[model samples]
Each structure stands twice: as C-alpha cells, then as structure tokens.
Target: MPSPRRTARQADLLERLVALLVAEGFASFTLDDLAERLRCSKTTLYQLAGTKQDLVREAVKHYFRGAADAVEKEIAETVDPASRVQVYLTTVAEQLSSLSRAFLDDMAQFPPAREVYEANTRLAADRVRNLIAEGVAAGAFREVHAAFVGEVAAATMRQIQLGEVGARIGLTDSEAYEQLASLIVHAVSS
Candidate 1:
C-alpha cells in the first residue's frame, strides 16, 4: 500500500492535471505529452495511475465529482427554490467553461469517462426535479408536473452538449446552458 502522504501527494497531482486534461484532451495526448504539459516527470504521473487510460478516467471522475459537490453546496446554502435550480445550472456551466470541444469529444470516446459524465447528468436531473417540487410547493413556480419538466430540461441539456441547438443558434455550449437556465427560470416563475 502507498503511504498516506504519498497518496495525498498523488491526489494533489491529479488536481493539477485535470485542468490540462479539460483544456487539451485525453484521447490524443501521450504520457510524455502530459508530463511535458504538467512540467513533471513521466514517472510522477505514473505514480498516479498504472496507465494513461486509467489516469484520464480517474481525473474525469474527479472533475465531475468535485463540480457536483460544489453545486450541491451552493444549492444547500440557499433557501429560495428558484435560486436552487438557477445555482445548479449556473455552477454546471461555470465548471464546464474551460472544457474544450476536443476534450468533450475525448470523454465521449472513452467509455469510463463517458459513464462518469452520464452519472453526473442523471444526478443533476434528480436535483432539478427536487428543486422543481420545492418551487411549486412554495408557489415560486407555476403548477406543472415537476418530474416531467425536469426530464425535459435534462434532455434539452443533452442536445445542447451534442452541439445541435448551439450549432444552429451559433452559440457555444456554455452559452447555451446559460440560456437554458434563463428559459427554465422564466417558464416556472409565478
């Protein structure tokens, strides 16, 4: 087993590397490429994972988990139901702002990374559904089936990621998500 200090140091390295992975991509970058970009030795990166694929998968998972946790924390601090959903959407967009198209495509190409993304998507949908219920109860939102609306919102978000809505409308994916938050807030406003 690795020493606790060594494990902590490896975790720190992963944190440093995830941003590079987001801006560049995982699919095409070699281990040497990653080491050079990170300004670290290849051996140091190897200590984080046995192989490049494992490192990419683990970093992608860490990114999603960290982003999700931050969103949840922000939502928890708010009592306003409308703000809860808005916070969720806004935080999601902000977290993904640095992510490049190439990086996103790489995630889609990797099954393990894709699974991590999909899991976050599902969790966001559930949280949105709950927020809708809260909003309706508090009369902050119009009377509607919260579950169905949340599912629709989640589905639309997926299309935005696919570049369908953003492509036709000439907006980036991050911009599309911001627009979506606005639309959702207005649609449910009482």
Candidate 2:
C-alpha cells in the first residue's frame, strides 16, 4: 500500500528518521523507541507507514532516493566527462559513509529494502557506463571496452556490499569504497 502524503513536518521527520536508521537501524528499534528518537508520537510514526516493517521499507527507499538525487545533481554540475565517473563513484562512497553495519544487517533481513539497494547499484553501473561513453566521445578516456569496465565496477561494488572487502582486508565498507573511488578516479585520469 502507498503511504499517506507526508506533510512538511513528516518530511522533516523522515529525514531525521533516515539519519537515525543509517546510524543505528530500525530492526532493533521498537515503535516506542522510534517515537522517542524521532521526537514524535507512535501515532505520528504510524502515519508514515502502516507497520514497523513498512516504515523501515519506506525509510530505506527514502534514503536511496535522496542519495540518487544528490549523486545525479553532482554529476550534472560537473564539467569534465572523465571526472563525471569519478564524481559518480565518490558520491556513492560519501553516501556509504553514513551507513552502519547494523543498518546493512537490517536491510539484509528485509528483502524489499535490499532490493532497493540492489536497484541503486545497478543504476550506478549504468551511470558509470554512460560516463565512460561520454569520456570516450570527448577524447578524455582511451578507446576501451565500456561494458567490461562497467561490469567490473558493478561486481566490485557487489563484493563491497557483501562485506567481502571488509571481511578479508579488515577495512570498513566506507573505507573500502573511499579507496575504490580513489582508485577509479586515478585510473580514469587522462
């Protein structure tokens, strides 16, 4: 079911809620806990969604939507086509910084929220491909296989999301992403 239209107050509350969920996660938070942390009543919380799971799903979607918007805005304002790819990847890294392990775990437990994350990653890969094409057209990047590059980036991102990087290297997901962005930018530099 669709959520009710959020008033300005509710929209503001959703931002706060996303921040909280990013840091702590909703899986462990009861409705009362959410009300306390979000500084609203249980009734107000229910207004956001029909149930706690529903609330969490909406919150995850909201977070991804906001992140996607910000990433697109950053890419749009960028002047260099080669740098667009860098900005795209690094913007995602910056967004990943706010995500805590608990939050990731919560999403893993919730398939719908996980699907939202996966969809964003797929879109990210597509954006990477587009940036590569732009760079090639502008003579900023070498004539290389953009599809192969995109697939590699997408796979690397998948491993990162699965915590394989952290599991093997003892680096946090955010740190891994930061390094990945740096490496990608350096590689793409003319």
Candidate 3:
C-alpha cells in the first residue's frame, strides 16, 4: 500500500489535473502542458498517475463519485420514493448544468476520453439501478425490472448531457430534472 503522504499527494495531483481539464479543454493540452499548468514536471505526473488516459479515467471517476454522493444524500433525506427519485434526477441535472462548457467541448474533440466518460456513465447507471431495486424491495415502486428502468434513466441523463432534447424544451437543469423525475415516477409506480 502507498504511504498516507504519497496517497494525499496523489489525490492533490488528481485534483489539479481535473481542474486543468475543466478549465482548458483536454484537447488543448498535452501532458507537458498539464505539468506546466500544475507547476510540476512531467515525470512527477507520470509517477502520480500512470498515463494520460489513466489520469483522465481517475478524473472522470472522481467527478462521478462526487455527483453520486450528492444524489445519494438527497435520496436519503427524502421520505417517499417519488420524492427521492425527483431529488436524485434534479441533483444530476443541476450538476450537468454546472459543468464547464469547455469540458463538454473537450469530450467532443477527444474521442478517447469517451472511454473514461462511459465508465462514469456506467457507475451512475449502477447507482440508479441500486436505488430502483431498493425502492422495489421496500414496496415503493411497481413490479418492473429495476435494471431496465435504471438503464433508461441513465440513457435519458446522457441525452440531457449531450444537449439532444432537454435544453430545447426550455427546461432549466432543474426543470429538466423535475420532468425526468415525473416520468420516472409514472413509469415505476403502479
């Protein structure tokens, strides 16, 4: 195992890398550029995170983990399943809205980043599936396939992220979330 100091330093490096990615589109920067931005040497970066792809994967995972934690907190605080689902979707939508446009633009420019992106997407989907399964077990939702509902919810969120449908409807992130929550509740509730 790594020493605590090493672990903390790695964490800090990861945060800096993520901040750089969020600020400057990923396509605009090379590893050397990232090292310059972070005021560190490329060797240090390689030591901290194996490769650029690994760094991106860690950054994406960290981002999604934070988002999932926020949504889980909202779900835990709500009483009813419907309200919980609403809070969850709303939280996700709000997060997506808060994301830097440069970040999205970067994802569009660098297709390799999609691998990391998709991993985060799968993590989010798994969380939704677990939430749905819990609601079903608690006799809150209908007798449908939790996995299917979770996949659909995840796909819908991705659509929103891609700016395919939700934004066109004048749905602020919050409004889009409310709409999604309503749809999910209607689908799952008997």
Candidate 4:
C-alpha cells in the first residue's frame, strides 16, 4: 500500500530531526528529549515513528537517503568516468562529514541503524564498481578488477563507519573516504 504523503510541516520536522540526530547522536535522546529539542510534543514525534528506537532508525534511513540523492546529483554533473568515481566518493565523504563520533558510536550500538549503514555501504560498493567499469570501458582507466576494487573500498568504508580506521590511523571518516577516493582514482588511471 502506498504510504500517505508527508505534509510540509512533517517534512520540516523530519529534516530537523535528522539534523539534530546527526549533530548530537540519537542513543542519548529520549522521546521527551527529542520532543523538547525539536520543540514538538511526544505525540507529534510518535506521528513520525512508533517508538524511540523506530524514530532513530527512521532518522538514520532518512539521513542516508538524502546523502545518496546528493551524491548522485553531484556525480551527474561530472562527465568523466574517473571524475565520476572521485566525485562519488568525495561527495559521500562530504555527506558523512556531518556525522559526529557520538553518532557513529550510537549507530554501532543500535542494530537497526547499523544495518541501514551497512546496506548503504553495500550499495555504494556496487556504485563504485559500476563507475570503475565505466572508466575502463571508456579508456579513462586501465584494465583492472573493478569488483575487487569496489569490495576493498567497501571494506574500508565499513571500517571507517565502525571507527576502527580512526582508532588505528587517527583519520576521521571523511578523511579516510577522501583518501580512498584518491587511491581508487590513482589505481585506475592509465
């Protein structure tokens, strides 16, 4: 069944909810806390989702959805296959720059939110693979195993999201992503 369309007010509330969670993390926020922070009532929050956990999950999904759209939009503006791959990863990094360490830790602890991130990572890997394949076909990149590169990139992204990369290398997730983009572009260049 089709879901009911969101009203402008609900959309604005959701955007605000996403920004607040991205800035501060959601695990520490109670429904009442979200209500007060968002300047809405608990009942209004319930209209967005049924419970606090669901609300957090919804916000995480919303954040990724918006990020995906933004990445694609930027990629569309770039013509070269190599540049597309670079643009894709760098845009992803930019989108993720807003995520606080607290938010990453909270996502790791929350299975639903963690799963959303995992699924998004997998999709991004596929996108990288496609972009690399395009570069090879276009002669913008040398012949290399696109799938292997994509999987490696995906693994790095997972570690970045998990905070393992930062713990070991002291690089923020965004920095790691930018490095990954550069590495992939260099590796694929003819």
Candidate 5:
C-alpha cells in the first residue's frame, strides 16, 4: 500500500489536474502549461502520471468517480429501480449542463480526452447494467438484455450531454432526462 502522505499528494495532484482540465480543456495544456499553471515541474508530473494520456485518463476517471458516487448514493436511497435510474440520469444531465462551455470546446480539440470520456461512458453504462440486472432479479423490470439497455441508456445520456438531439427537440436538460427515463421504464418494466 502507498503511504498516507503519498496518497494525499496524489489526491492533490488529481484535484489540480481536474481543475485545469475543467477550466482550460485538455487541448489547451501541455506539460509545460501544466507545470506553469500548477507551479510544479514537468519531472514531478511525469513521476505522478507518466504520459499526457495517463494524466488525461486519471483526470477523467476522477470526474466519473464523482459521478459514480452520486449514482451510488441515489441507488442506495431509492427503493424502486425506475426511480433510481431517473435520479442517476437526471443527476448526470445536471452535471453536464453545469460544465463550462470552454471545457466542452476544449474537449473537442483533444482525441485522447475524447477517448478518456468514452471510457467513463462505458463505466456509467456498466453501472446502469448492474442496476438493470438487479431490477430484473427483483421482478421490477421485465426480462431483457441488461447490457443492451445499459448501452442505450448510456448513449442517450451522452446525447443529452452533447446536446445534439435534445437541443433540436426543444427539451431542457430536465425534460430530456424525463423523456429518457420514461423510455427506459417503458422498455424494462413488466
């Protein structure tokens, strides 16, 4: 196990990295930029997280970890699978809406960041899959492929985050979430 001090340092570095990613977007920063912005040396960052891709991965993971925590909390608190899924989707929508446009604009410029983003997406999909599987076992949801429903739900969440179809349909984030939740419930409930 890592020492407590080392763990704390890693946490601090991750926090700083996340703030930088959120503020300037991943494309706006190089090793030198991060070194200057965080007042640390490139060597230190290298020691902390080998490559830029690694840094991006860690930062993206940190962001999604927080999202997952929220989803977990929602699951623990909600008795019904449908309500739990709605809370999870709505929470994600709210988070995406709160993200800085600069963050989104910058994210567009980085392929690695996109990859990291997609990985987090799969993580979210797995969470939804687990939820669906549990619901099915409890007879709250009809017999269906949990993985397929999870993938669709995850893709729908991404669509909302990207504001592609949701904006075209004149749906606010909450409205889009409700619509998605309704569809998910209809598809899964017996």
Candidate 6:
C-alpha cells in the first residue's frame, strides 16, 4: 500500500531530517538529539516515523529517491547513448560525493539503510545495462554483454561505496565513479 500523504509541515520536517542525517550521520543521534537538533519535539518526529531506526531508514530512502530522480532528469536531456551513460554515472557521482564518511559508515553498519543502498545499486546497474544496450542498438558502442558489464559496474560501485576504492587507490567515491564512467564509455565505444 502507498503511504499516507505528508502535511506541509511534516514534509518540511522530513526534508530537514534527510539533510541532517546526510550531513551529520544518524548512527550517533538519539531521538532526543534529533528533536533538539531539528528544533522540533520528539512528538513531531514520530509523525514522520515511528522509531529512530524507521526515521533513519525513511530519511535514507528519501535521499536516494531524490538522487535517482535528479539523475533521471539529467538523463532525459541527453540524446547520445554514450553520453547518457556518462551522464547517468557522473550524475550519480555528483549526487553521492556530498556524503560524509560518518554518514557512509553509518549506512554500512545499519542493515535497513544498507539494504536501501544495495537496492539502489542494483537499480543503478540495471540502468547501466539498459543504457549499454541502447548504445549497442544505436551503433554507438561495440557489441558486448550489457548485463555482465552492468554487474561489473555494480561491483565497482559496491567497492567504492565501501571505501575500498579510497583505501586502495586514494580515489574518492566521486572520482572513482568518474573513472568508471570514462572507462565504460571507452571500452564500449567502437
């Protein structure tokens, strides 16, 4: 079932919650801390979500949904399939580059939030696969296994999100994604 609609105030509060969690991370914050930081009562927050974990999950979902929408909006404007692939990944990189380490670590540790991220990663991989397929169909890219390439891209994204890319190569998540976009485009181009 669809969720009930939020009132303007509730919507505003949820937006604030998403921003706060993204900027500061949610793992250390208590409900009381959130209420105080948001300048609203705990009661107000309960209207947004039942518990702290639920609130964090909701906020994470809100963030990713918005990011996906923005990426799609950018993709809609680009005409070339190869350019679309680059735009899609780079746009995602731009969206994610703002995340703080604390927020990312918290996401990794929190099962619900982690699941949201994983699901989004899979969605992203599917998107990449489709984009690759389109490129091949348009004769913009050489024939390749789009599904396999998408999974490879997803695996690289997983590593980037886990901070492994940063640890091993000293590349920030955004930089790694940019590299991935370029590499994919180059490898696929005829």
lDDT for each candidate structure: 0.82, 0.83, 0.70, 0.91, 0.71, 0.91
- Model 6: ten consecutive residues of lowest lDDT: 1-10
| Model 1, residue 140: C-alpha shift (Å) | 1.4
Measured with C-alpha atoms, the lDDT of residue 182 in candidate 3 is: 80
TM-score of each: 0.88, 0.90, 0.73, 0.96, 0.72, 0.96
Q: Using lDDT as the measure, name the better of candidate 5 and candidate 6.
A: 6
lDDT per residue as tens, model 5, 1-190: 2223346766787788787777667766788988888888888787767898777766766776676677677678889876666666666656555445566655545666666566666676677788889888888888999888988988876776565664588775456766876788778888
User: Backbone clashes per model, in order?
Assistant: 0, 0, 0, 0, 0, 0
Model 4 segments more than 4 A misplaced: 1-4
Pairs in steric clash, model 5: none
Candidate 6, residues 68-153: lDDT per residue as tens digits? 99999999999998799999999999999888778988998999999999888889889999999999999999999888888899
After superposing candidate 6, which stretches have Cα over 4 Å from the reference?
A: none
**Candidate 3, residues 147-174: lDDT per residue as tens digits?**
9999898887666555555447755444
C-alpha positional error of residue 182 in candidate 4 after TM-score superposition, expressed in Å: 0.6
Better of 5 and 6 by TM-score: 6
* Candidate 5 similarity to native, TM-score: 0.72
**Cα lDDT for residue 45, model 6?**
95
Q: What lDDT does candidate 2 reach at residue 112?
A: 79
Q: Which ten residues in a row have the lowest lDDT in candidate 3?
A: 1-10
Model 3, global lDDT: 0.70
lDDT tens digits, residues 1-190, model 4? 2234778988899999999999999888889899999999999888888999988988898899899999999999999887999999999999988998889889999999999999998899899999999999999999999889888888888898788999999998889999999999998899
